[model samples]
Every structure is written in C-alpha cells, then in structure tokens.
Target: MASDPNTAPHLFDRALLRARMDRARRAGPVAFLLDRVVEDMADRLQAVTRGFSDVAEIGSPGELLPWPLADRFASITRVDLDESETLPLEPESLDLALSALALQFVNDLPGVLTQIRRALRPDGLLLAAMVGGDTLTELRQSFAAAEAECEGGVSPRVAPFADLRDIGGLLQRAGLALPVTDVDRVVVRYDSAFALMADLRRMGATNILIERRRIPTRRATMLRMAQIYAERFADPDGRIRATFDIIWLSGWAPHDSQPKPLRPGSAKSSLEAAVKRAPK
Candidate 1:
C-alpha cells in the first residue's frame, strides 16, 4: 500500500536542500547533467507523433523546456521542488508533465507520482529523469571504507538511489499505464574526490540525508577517503571517476485507446501446436 504523503517518513532535510539550491543558483548552478537530460527529453518529445497543448514542469531548478517545446504548449506551469508532494493543478488539467534532475530527494516518491498521475488528463504523458542506480557509487564506497577504517563505523554519507525496476513499479503502483523506465550512466573524471565533492556542492547535490552526520567529517577521514578513491577508481592518468546514473521514467494516464494486456488463458492457439508448425 502507498503511504500517505502527509505522514511519509522524513528521509531528507527539505529545508536544508532548499537553502543549498538557493545558494547554488546564486553562484550559478553546474548544469551539465541537467542540460544533457533536457536535451534527451526534448529529443524523445520530438519523436512522438501527437502534440501537447498544456504542460507543467515540476521540481526543476529553472526553466528546462527548450524553445520548440515551450512553443508546443499553449500554457506552461513551473512548480518548485517544495510543492511536489501536493500539486496545485486540478485533476485532468495537464496534457503533459516534465521533470529533470529532481524527484530523487522526495521522501514519498509514490505519493508524488500519485499526485502527478491525478493531475494528468486521460492519455496524458509524464516524462522525468532523476539520479538513480549506481550514481556516485565510487564515492559512496570510498566514504564507507574510510569511515570503517578511520572512524570505526559508517554513517549515511550519500543518499540511496532507486533502481530502474523499482521506479517502473512505482509508476504502475500510481495507476499509470504502459510505464517505461531506463538508465543512462555517465562517468565523469575528476582530479580528486575533493574536486567531485566541490562539483556536487555547485550542483546543489550535496548530502542532505536526515541521518547524515551533523558535525563536519574529520580531516583525517576526508584525506583517507580521497586516497581510497584514487587507489580504487583512478584512470590511467590518475584522475578518479565519478558515476551518475540518470534514470528516465515515462507513463501515460490510462485510456481506452491504449493497448491492453492479454488476459490469462486468452490465447487461441497452444504453444505446443505453434512449435509443431514451425520449420525444423
């Protein structure tokens, strides 16, 4: 059963995340990841034969729809990250919904997707991209190893990411039809783990887990983490690798025109008969 949005466990510090985002915006966000996903989303949108007149972009740092996409929609609404749990739009109000590099921080992902599903019109579409799978795996492992050896234990350093199958299941659970999910893994090279950490701050993607260590990481532990990262994940040139897995999800509001699955025992021919008829 899906948990109530109001009572969902607080896995993230949303207030802190908001402040971090504000600071990153003031300093100019590191938008390479966002740009890449938006471009890919635009390409996907272009491939669809139909057109969307009304659209909403939820939880994006800034305007993401490019020129042609913006032109396609008669009206476009941009919702901030804080409002994702309870959307302002009415039921059946939107023909399309888009989100880029958001939703991962959401405490109740199923609740948010349910809200989005409610807002979409019959046959309306939802397209989103979020960090998931093995994103920042190297850093996460290095931190764990360093903390285990130096600090004697590991606290939550990086946020947990959902796998593609898990996301697909959420879409289905939210009453969406024909749900699809895929991953695009990106490997970034950095001179050191510190460089990667700096970029994460610039992207407003630093640690905000509710269980994160409130105190600063020890300097010795930090140094050891960097060293472990270099020793394990470094390339031929000595630069370390950081991974970001962008998981894409799409689903449509149920409609009669949409394809339906075959019912159990509905097949007219038996598998044995079909195999017998095949060429040797």
Candidate 2:
C-alpha cells in the first residue's frame, strides 16, 4: 500500500543516495565524520555496565564499529542501507541497536524508529547519531544568496535537519522510554568553499533532496556562491567555517524494571510549597 503523504513525506531521493554511496565506496569513502562518531559511541557504550548479546548497526561505514565492539557483542548484524525503512529484523530480537550519521536521510523517520523500537527487546537500548540543527548553514546561506542573485530565484540545495526537541519527541512517539538527546557541534575549517564542496562530494553527502534542481548549477552561480561564502563565513585566516551539529539520541524499550513518572496529580507537596523550600 502507498504510504500516506501526510505521515511519510518523501523529502529525500533514496535511490540517488544509494548510488552516491556506492560511488563513494568505490572511490574510497572519506569517513572522518563517521570515524569520529564511532569513537564517541564507543565511549558512551563504556559507561553502560550491561552487555548486549545481539546488536544491530545501521549506517556505519565499513567496519568502523568492529574495533570498539570486538570483544563485546556476541553477534553484530549490519543492516543494509536499502533495508533502512523496512529494517528486516524479527520483533524483540535485538538487545542493542545503533545507527551513525545516517538517519537524517530517512524519508519516514518515525516509521523507521517505530520499527527499531519493535525489534528491540524489553529494556533494550537504542543509540543513534544524526546530523541536524544548523549543519551546513554556511553552504545553505551562500547558495541561497548566489542563486537569488544569479538565477532570479533560489532552489532547495540543502536538506532540512531536525532539532534536538524534535528528535526527543520522535523517540517518545516511537514508544521508546527515557528518551535522551544531546548535541555535538563540530566546526570544520576549509581553505575555501570549493574545498568544503569537494569534501562533501567525497563523503557522498551532496543534496539528494527529492525536489532538488535537476540541471547543473551555472558556473557564474557557483563562483558567486564561493565569493559569498568567503565574504560571510570566512575567518581572518582566509579559511571558511562549516558547522555540523551531531545530535545524539538514546532510548530504551519499555519494561517493568524502568522507572516511571509519578501520576499527574499524585505529588505530595504542592508547587508553592516546593518553591518555598527551594534554596534562597
């Protein structure tokens, strides 16, 4: 059955994204961002004393996770990118699930997350990281300015990313408990805007929006974009800055062992009384 457009708005062209990823893999994937995220995931996992037996990793580039999880999980299943939406896993099969730097491209994030939640065992953990919140703001701004100047109008050049609060709500909507969200803002400097574009190409992170312009960007527009980027986002040292906000999200499947919130009207002390007891 066709998905309802209201619930599953198709923002990304998944086929194009897959092709780009294949091209990047053939050209030796430039995976600095993925590597960084994997390391952070490792550190976070260290804080949890419990061990996970059946774990699934989605969107992780080429063995980036195996090193950190070498002696850990009994089985590590790698979910293919094509199966991102369906997530071909049995219900309540996984003890842990993780995705790195990939969920942002999913067309139906809520549906995908619901699938993950269902696949997780009771009290199983779900940890993921995705780019969001002002990521590529410089490029988006530069392109908008340049396109408006050169083409009389602007087109969709960058993907819209979710914010921290939106992700937290998604976790709750997916029936995951104790939803926690955080951000890791990483600012990278490049010699020029063109250099940053090249890195994005190498990373296969170019615009694959469903409504993206089909024709090639005009040379004049490209040049003007570079000029505007330098003018607005470059530092005194002549390097342009790009911001990438990595939003980290973690939640657990509901279980009796987990703590539950108090009933709405079950508080012993009134708000006024609590305020009077506050440190002054």
Candidate 3:
C-alpha cells in the first residue's frame, strides 16, 4: 500500500518544505553551480552502458542532462516524489536507473530502494549518488551551538546521511546484488557561512524534517553560529569551508540464470593460482 504523505516515515517538516520551495525559486544559479558535478556523474554512468532502451532519472531534471544526453536515451522518464510514498512507474520496466544527490531526503530509504529495485528489469543497473555523513560539518556545528543557546537542547538541523557501508547494506537488503559503494568529498569555500546556506537553499536543499517542532531561531543565535563557524572552520584566508561527502552506489537485480565462476573443486588449481596464471 502507498503510504500517506502525512503519516509517511520520511516526511519533510514545514520548515524543510519552505526551505525547498525557496531553493526551487532560485534554481537558476544553483543549477549552474551543480552542473559540473551532475555532468561528471552522468558521464560515468554513460561509460558503463552498452546500450539502454529505457532509462529512469530520479530527482533533479538538470542533473540528467546539462547539455542533452537525452538524445542517447531510448525512453527517458523523470520521476520526482515530493510527499509521496511510491514511485510513478511500473515494476520491472526500466533498463537503467540513475539518481544524483536525491536519496538523502527520503524518510524511508529502505522502502524507496525496494521501489527502485522493483522498477528495474532483470539485470538492470542502478546508480545513485547522495550526500553522506561528513557533509556540512561547519554548518552543523553552528546549528548545534545556536540550538544550545536558543533552545534548551538541539534538534538535528540537517537530516542524517547514510554511510558507504550502510548504503551497501541497504542495497543488499533491497535484494540488489553486486552492490558497490564509495565516497567522494567535495570541499567548497565561501566568503561566509551565510553564503554557504544561501548556496544550499538555492540548490533546493534545506531542512525538511516532518517531525520538527517549531522553534524560532533568535537573531543572536544566528550571529553566534556565524561567529563560531568562521572561527572554527575557516581557511587561512578567512573564508569558511564546507565539505560535501557524496556517496556513490551501484547494484544489479538478482537473476536466476546469471553466470558464475567455477566452484572451488570445479577448478583444477586454487582460484588464487588460476588468477595468477591468467594474463595481466
């Protein structure tokens, strides 16, 4: 059954929705900045394909085609889920699935993965990239301090991120085989912490926790956060640095007739010996 938006596990809060709307309004500049990263990921995915008759791109529209890789796709469908439980596609239909910087917002990551796996045909490939735990250290620290001063305690400002190991495990749990995961850290420098927040907002990435309680942040808290951010994580040139850890994951659906290497006894010599004797 499709989960209700209100009752869904990964519901985005009002503050987060407002943030995303604000970011969407300024998508022009944000898209420009993120173009390079999107293009790189697309290129990598393209290289792995022999040919794809059907492809599905989740999340950002601009990420799919900075210039126009759409021509290469046989049937390209874009899926964007905001406050929804199920993907808007049939099961076992897609040949290739790609998502860049999109999965972090999902409240039910495992459920979402199940949907993706179901959407792919036998042997279909899924490649995704999402922001991971080490992202926005400076901003998180500042927010923690602000919460400590303004509120009695701090609630998580940014949503929790999945680690590489966890992501691989998620793929396995979702019934995806040959799952591989890796991380890439992109360090961005800004004139101030405010600029960093502005960039994130422009990228349609802001707080969207559905369970978040309303607590107005004081101006003093903001200022203190900025001060701490600058002092603690500033570069020698006095600019603030924010690190975005991008996690890359790829997997294939299991198939009954999939080829397998010889078993231990099937080979004359040990597997290690066979590998050593094979051509370099």
User: TM-score of every model?
Assistant: 0.97, 0.95, 0.84
Candidate 3 displacement at residue 131 in angstroms: 1.3
**Which digits, one per residue and each the tens of the lDDT, describe model 3 over residues 17-118?**
545755577665466435655776767766875566798888653546545666777788888755554688798999888887778777767878888899
Rank the models by TM-score, top first: 1, 2, 3
Best by lDDT: 1
In candidate 1, position 32 carries an lDDT of 91
Better of 1 and 2 by lDDT: 1
Assess candidate 2 and give its TM-score to the true structure.
0.95
- lDDT for 163 in candidate 2 is 100
Q: Which numbered prediction scores highest in TM-score against the true structure?
A: 1
| Worst window of 10 by summed lDDT in candidate 1 | 80-89
Name model 2 segments beyond 4 Å from true.
Answer: 1-7
* Stretches of model 1 off by over 4 angstroms after superposition: none
Tens digit per residue, CA lDDT, model 1, 1-280: 4568678878899888999998899888898999899899989998887889899999987678865667888999998768336678798999999999889999999988988899999999999999999999999999999999999999998999999999999999999999999999999999999999999998999999999999999999999999999999999999999999999999999999999999999999999999999999
Worst 10 residues of 3 by lDDT: 1-10
Ranking by lDDT: 1, 2, 3
Clashing pairs in 1: none
State the local distance difference test value for candidate 3.
0.77
What lDDT, from 0 to 1, does candidate 1 have? 0.92
- The worst-scoring run of ten residues by lDDT in candidate 2 lies at 1-10
Over the stretch 184-237, how does candidate 2's per-residue lDDT look in tens digits? 999999999999988888888999999999999999999999999999999999
Q: Which one wins by TM-score: 1 or 3?
A: 1
